[model samples]
Target: MEAIAYERATNIADAVKAAREPGTAFIGGGTNLLDLMKGGIAHPLKLVDITHLRDDGLDAVRALPDGGIRIGALMRNSDAANHTLVRERYPLLTQALLAGASAQLRNMATIGGNLMQRTRCPYFYDTAFAACNKRAPGSGCAARDGYQRLHAILGASEHCIAVNPSDMSVALAALDANVQVVGPDGARQIPIGEFHRLPGDRPDVDTTLRPGELITGVDLPPSRLADRAYYLKIRDRASYAFALVSVAAALQVQGDKVAAARIALGGVAHKPWRASIAENVLIGRTLDDETLREAAAAQMRDARPQHGNRFKVALAERGIVRAVNVAAGREPAGVTGAPA
Candidate 1:
């Protein structure tokens, strides 16, 4: 790891000031940052330790003018998951958090850090590898053709195909979460759907965050859509492994027909892949296996699989069916994937 200067910030302003320097980054939990540094993936010139900034630290989730939950960026994953408000109001969010890494990791990881965690592409992790566009700009993506079982199926371009690895993000996107960013220009809120981005032509840039801009909070809109929702994660292992294909679905069931639904897919996209088509299909339909199969297939209509990840397309469909069924209070029949 490169030698880097470290500074403890007493407040948000100091943290912002320290992060304004070139090649400097704000440290929240340091879990991802330190790991990337040791792996030679990120060698920052300066690290502004913001965990000590108590007041500015992400905390508090309050009702906002837009009938949304304003979540402080510094809130830990564990706390957010177990929070009475979150669990009661958004069970899908809680389920997504429990489906992620170990409890200890969740305790240490912050909401902002979770959203900012980078891709789990093997090429990106191996420093000796020369073809990781995200780790090194214009270096090319080796995963495009080499051992890519966990690569993306949607929103991928020629430049990159690494999937964003956050189960909670899928639920948040399905719930219509909003991101609040604080920078030198003050503050602004970005809807969670637009907060994460596809590689497009710039694989090097994974998110919409600008240099020196800090994530202040995440705002989740009030939803009748979320009252009935489910989150399901399927991985190679029963525990501690990254997702193979995950689903976060929220449904508004009126009698036998669906009034509304929100669906997002994980592990098969550059970011959380919301199944808008699937949601549209459910708005006026019934929650049955046939309807689920149709919506699930529609969700993957344009999914272009890569060298070793064709199974992900099938797994993604099954995942959506199971998750949606679970959300609709069904028995999750014929769900051929690992339980979350």
Candidate 2:
């Protein structure tokens, strides 16, 4: 392990100021960053501890005046999932959070850390491998032809095929949440859809955050899909496994037809993929099996699955159809897909 320095930040300003220096990283729960550091993937000279900024309300989950909710960045995943407002209003987010990691990890992982978690591609984690574009830009992606079972099937570039490993982010994308950040230029809000980036040419850049920017909180707008929402995760096992294909589905139904729909996918792309095509198809249609299949197919029509993960195409389609059916109350919530 490398020698490192640590500083406890008193407030957001203090944290941001310390982070402005080169080779400085802000630490909250240190769930993912510590692992990256141990694996030699991330090497920060100084760690700015921001978990003590509760006086700034960076650990609170408060309801917004605009009929929305703002979750402090430092809020623990377990606490956020069990918060009364979150459980009552944004059940999908709660379900997604619970579906991730183990209970102990969720207890220690913060909302900000969860949003910033890196990919689980073996090629990226193991430095012995010399061909990981995400780790060493310009190097070829080893996972392109090696152990691609967990690789991406959508929105992938030749430089990288790893997938974003955040279940909370998938739910947030479906809810149209916004990320609040503070940097050298002051605070600004970024839409969740635009916050995470696809692996274009520059596969190293995962998010749109500026250098030294600190995520303060996440804002979720008012939504009517609370009663009709479902978060479906399909993994290799029943617990403590990363998703193979996950779907967050929320629908607004009027009488027998769908009034509005929101769908987002995880474990299939570099970022949480918003299924706009599927949403558009379901907006004015009834929740029939044929309609659900059509929506799922439309969502995956352009998917470019790799050889090892071709099963993901069918799995994703089935997962989406099942998620939407549960969200629309057309089917019961239960496990229904084969393991990927």
Candidate 3:
């Protein structure tokens, strides 16, 4: 990366002002920004270090008046995953974090940075490539008919098909985590499910974060059901690698009948893929093989896959079935290679 002007904002006000300038981006952990800059994917004229301004109780998880837990944006992934509240209440989130990159990466990577990482699509990251809708809107999506093992099967558009790459986010989605943003307009809260957007017609823009808006905190809701929740990720390696198909599930089973189920899948969609169809299918049913298979099938009723990654369809079904078994009070059977 060429030498770029750098500045540090010690407070949110200063950070907001610096971030509003054109070609100026905020740097929290610098894990994502630095990599993007070095690869020429991001050419911010000014790099404003907001890492210090983010020192507002990022390590603590507090209960809110509205029955939610506030998680500071600067909190490290490792801290959040191992936190007492996280371990007891959001087990899936903890499992997801543990299955991610590594303990060292978890220490350096902030919760906010993981939520904002750029697409892992190789074409978009390499500046040498000419056409990538996310890198340059309206240019084109090379992955449209190219290598898409990790692309979306849902909410895809003509512009892009890359999946959002965050294991924590998928678990958070399953737990109904909310986001807290500070901006020139004022402070606001956005539900985690709504924080990121579908590809729609413009996949270049991944979120609804307004200009000068900064994600300062995240609110995780308390869920009694999540005490038994779990996350299962299937990847290419046992080490630091992204998921090929992952499931984050929280189910409340009462005497072989599912009282409630919150299901979300990763590595298969633009946003965290919530199994809305499957959730409806399992809400009041027993976890027999037939029921599990039906729910799994329902989730991918409209799934469309490419040449190299068509196996994801079958893999995703098995993942859904296994995740359902866990939700049904059975120990995950012979789960190998990775979680699920």
Candidate 4:
């Protein structure tokens, strides 16, 4: 590990000031940051410990007057997932959180840190490989022609095909939440759907956040559309595994027809992918397998899969249809993959 200066921030202002300096980053649970440091992926000259800023209500999940909720960035993932208000109002969010890392990791991982988690692409992690565009811009993307079973099929550029690995982000995208950030220029709110950027020419930049900005909390609008929501995760293992393909399905149904819907996919792109094409096709349609399959297929119509990961395109399509059906209560639980 590199020698670094550590400063424990007294408050939010102090943390913000420290982060404004070059080569400095704010630390929350240290779950992701520490791993990056140990792996030599991040070499910050100074570390601003912001975990003590919880006194400013950065660790609370409180209800807003508009029937929404504001979740502090420092709130642990486990706490936020199990909070009475979250579990009751946004069960999909809770299920998404619980589907992530183990209980111990969830207890130590903060909501903000979870959002900032790095990609799990093998080329990005292994220093031996010198062709990871995300790790070193302009180098090249090894996954483009190398082993890419878990790479993206949507919003991928020639420079990179890495996928975001956060289940929480998938749920947030489907919920249409907002991220609140405090910086030198005061504060600003970024829509959750637009928070992450695609791996265009510049795959190095993960989010739209400007330098020296700190995320204070996440704001969720009223849960009217999420009453019948579901998060379906399919992976190599049953538990403690990164998603091979996951779907977040929320619907506002009128009898057997869909009034409105929101769907997002994980483990398929540089960011949590909002399936707008699928949502648009399902509006006013009956909640049936045929309709669901059509919407799912439409969403994957433009998928560009690689040699080894072509199965992901099919898995994603089937996952989307099954997830939407389950959310609409038209299908039972424990169904996996497409019909034979």
What lDDT does each candidate get?
Answer: 0.85, 0.92, 0.81, 0.89
Tell me the TM-score of each prediction against the true structure. Answer: 0.95, 0.98, 0.94, 0.97
Each prediction's number of clashing residue pairs: 1, 0, 0, 0
- Residue pair clashes in candidate 1: 58-74
Residue-wise lDDT of candidate 2 within 18-58, one digit each (tens)? Answer: 89889998899999999999999998999999988755568
Off by more than 4 A, model 4: 335-340
| Residue runs of model 3 more than 4 Å from their true location after superposition | 1-3, 333-340
The TM-score between candidate 2 and the true structure equals 0.98
Give lDDT tens digits, candidate 1, residues 236-279.
87667889898898888888889888899999998998899988
**TM-score of candidate 1 on Cα atoms, chains taken together:** 0.95
Residue lDDT tens for model 4, 1-340: 4789989987777888888889998899988888878887888999999988845569999999999999999999999999999998898899899989888999999999999998989999888899988988989999988999889999999999999999999999999999999888889999998899998999989999888899999999997766788899888876677888999999998887788999999999999999999999999988777888899999999999888899999999999988887887778856332122
* 301: Cα error in model 2, Å: 0.6
Give me the runs in candidate 2 sitting further than 4 Å from their true place.
335-340
lDDT of 1: 0.85
Candidate 4 matches the true fold with a TM-score of 0.97
